[model samples]
Target: MDIETWMRGYETAWRSNDGDDIGTLFTDDAEYFTEPWTPPWRGRDEIVRRWVERADAPGDWTFSWHVVGVDAGTATAFVQGETCYAELATTYSNLWVIRFADGGRAASFTEWWMDQAHASDGDGDGEELG
Candidate 1:
């Protein structure tokens, strides 16, 4: 499958913030890591659940790809994004390690977004901790 196509699907799904759509982009065993202060999820089921929970927002969650490095079956994509969490506004620079599935209809991916403390402090007083 083409990397561009894969990325398009991923990006579209992300913007939708619809877990049903986002979860469909990956294989059943694919894991998604979305931690600002907790353990990462390790499967599509978990990914969808958490994503749906996040979809309960005041405003839409948006993401923009900044840069990407791809080779063979793996890709590293960095993106800048923001989300409205109830009342607090949050922004982040997130990274993803994508491993395309071989002979499967889905791809394996892992997401690593910036820590909340780091985002709040902005290279200043607070200690950066993941």
Candidate 2:
């Protein structure tokens, strides 16, 4: 699949809320950089473990259009989303840098965010870290 198509599949998978579907998107050795100093998480198993433990109601999370930029076999895109996870519902945005493998699994996915790329929940505030 093309970059756009692959990205669309990921967005669809997020909406589907099927753990398997989301889990299956990553390569076995996928490396995920959630944030600076967070230490990149290696292996899809670890990544999915954290995701499952962190997510609240599945439907509470979703991404808008992903504008992809293609360069060779790598792709970059910005994702806008809103999510309510357990105790927090907030507007968020991020840049996802991805590298596609030979068979199309995500060899790497680095999410670049600004303060979680979060805005207020509209009803209230995003929790302050300090």
Task: Estimate TM-scores for all models.
Answer: 0.61, 0.67
lDDT of 1 by residue, 1-130 (tens): 4555666776666667777677767777776655534566667888788776766442455555644665653433334443333334665566666666764325556667764546543466665545
- Report residue 99 deviation for candidate 1 (angstroms): 1.2
* Model 1 spans with C-alpha error above 4 angstroms: 36-39, 56-59, 73-89, 103-107, 115-130
C-alpha lDDT of all candidate models, in order: 0.60, 0.64
Encode model 2's per-residue lDDT on 1-130: one tens digit a residue: 2566667667666666566766677888988788745788788888777766665464665556545555663443444433334235555556677777776678787776554434445555655443
Question: Considering only N, C-alpha and C atoms within 3 Å, which residue pairs clash in candidate 2?
Answer: none
Find the 10 residues in a row with the least total lDDT in model 2: 78-87
Candidate 2 vs. true structure, TM-score: 0.67
Among these predictions, the greatest TM-score belongs to 2
Model 2: lDDT to the true structure: 0.64
TM-score of candidate 1 to 2 decimals: 0.61
The residue ranges of model 2 lying beyond 4 angstroms of the native Cα positions read 73-89, 115-130
